[model samples]
Target: MATGLLTSEQAEQIVTTCRTAIGDSLRSVTYFTRDDYEQVYLRNDLERDADLSTFIGHEWRGFKTAQTAYEGSELGDYNYTIRVFDNGFLIRVTNESEGVFATTDGLTVKDFEEVATALNSFLGDREVR
Candidate 1:
């Protein structure tokens, strides 16, 4: 049965679609079964210079915003995180000098909006059992 919320199946679909869109750039997909989240990572090592790896790519993490705790509080929202590296990947999360900014870089703004629209459309199309 579908929970109609952010589930593992949905996460798989989202990550799979992302991999498809990213094509050869996709490096790996990490799923946290216990946490119910996914990480879609990409790399352009072959095409891009090794030194430019940071700016060239990043990772995507999606979760049920309602179930996950952010900043110590649960806001009951659906969202994702993009872990971006500007210089290198060895930088620590707490290092302020790394110049790494975490934002939504998985999908472009237009694509994200389109996905939202599709999800909304699915709500209407869903048939009750």
Candidate 2:
């Protein structure tokens, strides 16, 4: 698969995986590379015109940093991040070259693992642990 941007089929797979894990609470899906980003899906109830450029940039940097933060630590490989908010959650699954971050209304502890694991699987084994 290409690293620059997600193909429509890939984006659809992401949406389906996310919805399957998070159910109706899935809020938004954003795919980002080192240089650019795209919002593949946004729930109908959310704001359509919100400024996300700054947020996307932050997420990209944060994800990249997380990938290397614990090199050789006993905690093992980096997997994902879940940031809680008053209204929702931001779950980021990343590799060195590209990433997919999904926002959802809320999730059970198990839902978090399921979504992260599913997305990480979607990113695949070639991306490094």
Candidate 3:
């Protein structure tokens, strides 16, 4: 397959893999189809403050408002935001309460792998979607 060009079947497979990996650590995961983009969004709860820094440091690259592509933080009682791109397949982490933390380059399989790795590391488990 070409980088970033996943057939519907491939995308479904990826999502299934993510869901299996994260299991209960994930509170919710959804796939959205927009006019020009397809996305996978995930959210999890925050049990401790340390979880905040640890998760961010491990999963996200850094904060970048220019991209506004990915953002994550504590929002109310939950900490969430794992956004995967449709066209580029880049991933972004955002804290709902805080802001954008990190984002990948584009929608290549390599980028998907990176996002999957970060999600596994941050969540301390594997999730397919």
Output the number of the TM-score-best candidate: 2
The better-scoring model by TM-score among 1 and 3 is 1
Per-model TM values vs. the true structure: 0.30, 0.87, 0.25
Local accuracy of candidate 1 as per-residue lDDT tens digits, 33-96: 2212223333444232222233223311223332244635556443333344553212111111
Q: Which lDDT value does model 2 have at 19?
A: 91
Off by over 4 Å in 3: 1-6, 27-35, 39-115, 118-129
Q: Residues 35-65, candidate 2: write the lDDT tens digits.
A: 7777888998888775667777888889767
**Which tens-of-lDDT digit does each residue in 65-86 have in candidate 3?**
4234433433332233345645
Which rank order by TM-score, best down to worst?
A: 2, 1, 3
Query: What is the lDDT, from 0 to 100, of the residue 55 in candidate 1?
Result: 27
Angstrom error at residue 57, model 3: 22
Ranking by lDDT: 2, 3, 1
| Pairs that collide, model 2 | none
lDDT of 2 at 102: 88
